[model samples]
Target: MLPRRSRLTGASSSDRGLPNATVARLPLYLRALTQLRSQGSQTCSSDQLAESTGVSSANVRKDLSHLGSHGTRGVGYDVDHLRAEIAQAIGQTQDWNVVLVGAGNLGTALAAYPGFTSRGSRIVAVVDADPARVGEQVGDLSIESIDQLETIITERSVSIAIVATPGQAAQDVADQLVGAGVTSILNLAPVALRVPEGVDVRQVDVAAELQILAYHEQRKGHPREEAEVSR
Candidate 1:
């Protein structure tokens, strides 16, 4: 039997009411639960979830515990109930109005992504500094001028924004977003941003992720090279 610390808990002491590691893994659990629900699964074991999400079963159980969820020893967890719990925990139970800054290739692609809508976040406005890109169409949104950023945010009641501008322009856009009442930002730019105390920024650097993967590939190939050299 797992200890009390490993079992479901009613609360956490970490910042944001949950540990950062647990918060990060919640999405993985949610995604796995969503897939199971889609496949008509009514109950799933921690092992099953771990297999789907590539995490250790013990970690999976511990993470869910932080959300106050525990499964029966033999029957596991009710899939639908767990899914709802995770969604609510991650603030996906309600829709969030989001604004997009920068309408370049990466920005446009993000604006067109349907995954955000599934998570109850919708990009309500698209803005760019370049006048030529303004008035362009991205899905159901027309690119608006950067000049209208605050106005669009206020009119749409947007508190979340996606900053996909160039690395150089990202900080300026982030500043504008923070001034426009944006409390959360998804920054796709490679550069780090400095925002006010209460603002939350999540950075997504694709190039850096690829470089990390390249590092792993380099390590994996080194052993083969060493073996060949010894022959």
Candidate 2:
């Protein structure tokens, strides 16, 4: 399967001038820059950024070059300036209202996560199909009926949604979200969503990720067997 491109990055390489790899790494650069800024770092070299982000200095320079940033010969990139540039590149400068669908355990936790606001996307509403959950509060916002989904989205001008429904209900929730004008979705359900061309879906499957880590652990546990197989 082809890797999904994140809408948070604004545009694809085809639309913007950056390569796919550079676009993906922009977030890493921004994160490292954020940490540096917090530490009072005014300027940072390519090597410093590469070390912080676990990317090679050469790749760091190459990636920054795509943004028309070539650090000074003796100095380096200004941390504040780099952060602003990456923020603009990734559409973090703009506020993105998001709606959370499904008030189950996963959905509830997602609604309370503070990282979304820090990343420029805030969950403005939460909804679920369960009547019992409708009046419950996940954070500061009271849960609403899933029947009010479209209304909440339109009223808030929400363009992004988080789908934390069960695997069986994921597709349906995705359909509703798309129909309500959501262009981007962060899906935590196990099932993959099928949306139209313009819509973007990014799935986060914790169990699947853990299984991948288990595969690597198995390889480490049987290193001799793995080596023989390589032969």
Candidate 1, residues 148-198: lDDT per residue as tens digits? Answer: 999999999998999999999999999988988899999999999999999
For 1-231, candidate 2 gives per-residue lDDT tens digits of 333333344233355457878878998999899899999999999999999999999999988866656778889998998888789877899889999898888888888888778777888999988898888888989999999999999999999999989999999989999998899999999998999998988889999999999999999999799889978
Which residue pairs does candidate 1 place in steric collision? none
The reply for model 2, stretches above 4 Å from the true place, is 1-17
Candidate 1: lDDT of 166? 92
Clashes of each: 0, 0
TM per prediction: 0.90, 0.89
Which runs in model 1 stand beyond 4 Å of their true positions?
1-15, 224-231
lDDT, candidate 2, equals 0.87
